[model samples]
Target: PICLLDTIGKVFEKVIATRLSAAIEAAGGLSPEQYGFRKGKSTLDAISKVVKTAEEACAGSRWRGGSKSYCLVVTLDIRNAFNSADWSRTLEALQRFNIPGYLQRIAPNTSMVGFADDVAIVVVAKHLAAAEELANAAVRAVESWLTVAGLDLAAQKTEAVLISSRKAVETASVQVGGTTIRSQRAIKYLGVLIDTRLSFKEHLEYVQRKASGTAGALSRMLLNTRGPKQATRKLLTSVVTSQILYAAPAWAKAAQVKTYMRGVEATYRLCALRIACSFRTVSDEAALVIAGQVPLRELIRERAEIHTAVPGRHPRGHGGRGAAGRQRPEPQEGTGAGRDSQPSDEAGTSADPKRGHGSVQQMPTRGYVPIEVEEATAPFAVQAGQAAG
Candidate 1:
């Protein structure tokens, strides 16, 4: 579960209550900001409200000036939250804002897909909406591009969701298509504790254990009485969810996981574990960024070729030119050398007219065109050829 620090004192009160209460309720319940869907107020306005609330709460409190200045402890639990969402349409809407420089400089490539639908993007934005828009635009662009390329986009669902964080607010939520999901709450919750000393390994192990336990419980509930295949399928499903949800921020930064059109905080243990585990094997920031922004399938399909490039095997040679270079021909007949040997026919032209125009005739490799020459010119032609030779 994640916790958003609405106000420093309010969050502190919840933390203190952790020792006494078995059931933990959010300090001010869940905030809409947790899911990146807060509206009717600017970010600054929201911050001001939170700050004022904290000050009031701290006024006569024992922990310093709990009212004058309070710490909003937003905790993010990265264990099993759906941070990497499939909100293709939202991304498209955000991309319409077009902060290309930010995307290229920060965000790299993003590819998302579901069944017959797929979207791939190569940009990033400084804020969640921008990032979301880019993904949305890519989804539409990909859908259209694929359609033109003889593929389908609308035959299946394409979607995405993202999480973002700042010192003042918490956010999370789900989205289907391009619109913000307003009806659903997060299946799981998260709470993040900043400035902690716990090692990544320890935290990761804990999350893994927790995920395993959850999966086991679901498996038992659905499989023992439900059957072996159902049980096994649920196990795999849980594992995949765990894998995406549990990553080290070091490998890929956690998205602002949102649900019900708002943001929330995750446990510090979860955030630390994700960050720690993320940096383990992956090394590139671009790869990590894409991992955070897009889904697993589309990324794999779109980048498999580029990601698998080998030494001495040029990318253009393997396929064709990219956005700029001259395209290399594929291994098909009548395309390369054979093209130069054939003279394209013009519509409505007679054979004689074509021949009269001195157009090169496409002769069959097995046959030849025969010509008869005048005897008077033969001697002069022969003399000229002989002199040149």
Candidate 2:
């Protein structure tokens, strides 16, 4: 096998794509659920969504009638996703959405998500059965829409993941277009490894391997620092670090993953050390200084510093001190995040203790399993912060 890697799409192609995508999006052609390929929405939006949903499902409340909730996330590539846009079906969809005809004419080889050719559907429910039904319904809707749009669902590559306590019962497998979607202990969704346990251990290992692989290739390319000058080292370092920290703030929630990110940066540190011909045992902080790179954890933390970072502002959402911090809809009384009856000193997204949701519950641990509820009425508040926001 042979393959040629080229610079992403050409400049002119991207300009054309940007113009067309903006138009389509403005016309409501793209779904909000598709955080990828959009200008403002990011991988964090998608990840936080699934995470918040899973957290809520695991934290069952009386309002949910005490049913343990679970989450199933399905990701699939639209067959020939890029060029699969059908003229007739597009027009049909446009009409169905009431998009004006003036904006409906798309050039050949144009599509939503431009070069990003995948989509993911997330379903959260109070029980495995509800989750499966919701997932099935969502898949059917997408399948029908794709068929109409001259697209096919790559069911073979479709991945189904169940997120719940280990004590929770196994769920029936999901089927798309008569092909059964295989279950995975951990599946990469929007570039993050998500396991049923939400431990983030699998994601950490995957990123470690990915960063390690990139470092190996770079090492060979640099000829062990016998080639490439400072500029090259800096550029390569940037590229490798970017790979390691792609969505750091999301998966970094796991403490162990946080520690591993630092180790990944160490590989970059070693490469830099060798480039400077310094000893491998040199302090990591010193190597980072020589490489002109920030520690991976600190890099993510610094990025977090840029957003609406005025004094007293929350990590996300639009607000300032004395302002009600922005949040997702608070989980309802019977929902997962609202199970506890005692309120915390700081608002745990609840103030009045009247509802059983008023208290701060113990966070999930390896041995501890809490009940959860799937409440469309209340998605968990406190979304994952946008890594690129």
Candidate 3:
């Protein structure tokens, strides 16, 4: 195979030299017919400098060479790298560093939108350290410039790995997969904009209507005992009851399978908790969707009781003993929870400890059972009011 040496540093040095030579010749260092340059010691010196700089950069990359270390050269193609628009602060920093306005104006334009507009940079570094640093710097620069232009940087993903070499450098090579790989993407939550003009009934209806359709379909599937539910039940039973939960292969060196089963059990517990909470606000139709015909009696006796502390159910008017929609015990008057019980204090009103409330106990009003007209019209009461006036 032929080798292509990417001598960016070399090219940069050569351009600098050629330009300098041209400038000198323009000032009459050599005649125009001599092309203002020649092949000599000076050329060799420039090449040597370029080679040394490139070597230093390569050394920084961290490759194991000389037939000892396995070498991996990774190239990261940044999807939408430039349009990431994270640069306003960076540009400000540059200004503080005295980068001129003209330079800022002439900075590269990133007009592409969506995933298509991302910038990609090809880096040649010897080790992971140098390669990642170079890639990160390039990414940051694109982000900063985009920020100045009032654009948002989209989510980005990266891939990197070392290529495997069989036998020797001159032999055929193939790709390899490692035991683990990690990747990340950006997410932004713009502020919620709720329109208050929608009537409470309208909002409730909107939610109920949305729930009906989804819940109806889900409920049907759960009740279809011969379908997915059967499969799920079998899976759960196997994990909980089978030998696989407690035993491993005869040749196994560790409890890898048992540990995995434990993980599955933990996940089931978490999911049960979520389902219990969701059942509270869900409409009857939606509740049926999730619970299906799985006899609530059996489920409560089985899965729902996993967390004894979490209340399973309560009478419509009865308050319970957990964080779930229960009336908290009223604290004594001067205590922290009761401090805001006063009506005159707005801070007390807004900071009411019952922040996540489904309902609150209303204070009793001054004593007044319904009054009869005959008692209400008593002459003494009328006379007293007139006398005071």
Instruction: Name the candidate that leads on lDDT.
Output: 2
- lDDT by residue (72-181, candidate 3, tens digit) is 21222223434443445434433443444544443333221222231222233333344344434434443443444444333423333222222322211111121122
RMSD of each: 32.1, 11.0, 36.0
TM-scores, all candidates, are 0.20, 0.66, 0.21
Please list the residue runs of candidate 1 whose C-alpha ends up more than 4 Å from where it truly belongs after superposition. 1-123, 127-132, 154-159, 168-389
Ranking by TM-score: 2, 3, 1
Q: What is candidate 1's local distance difference test score?
A: 0.26
Tens-digit lDDT string for candidate 1 (276-328): 23333444444335333233322222223222221112222111122114332
Counting clashing residue pairs in each candidate, in order, gives: 83, 7, 12
| Tens-digit lDDT track of model 2 for 1-389 | 65543656556456665665655556654433444545565565556556765666666554257644566777767666546554554455445545444445543244343335455655655556666765666666556645544567787788878877746446457879898875688888877898988888887767767877877777766664367887676667556666766655556556445565555656667666655556767787887677655455655554344322321222431112212343333456664543233323211221112222221111111100111122233542221111000
| Model 2 TM | 0.66
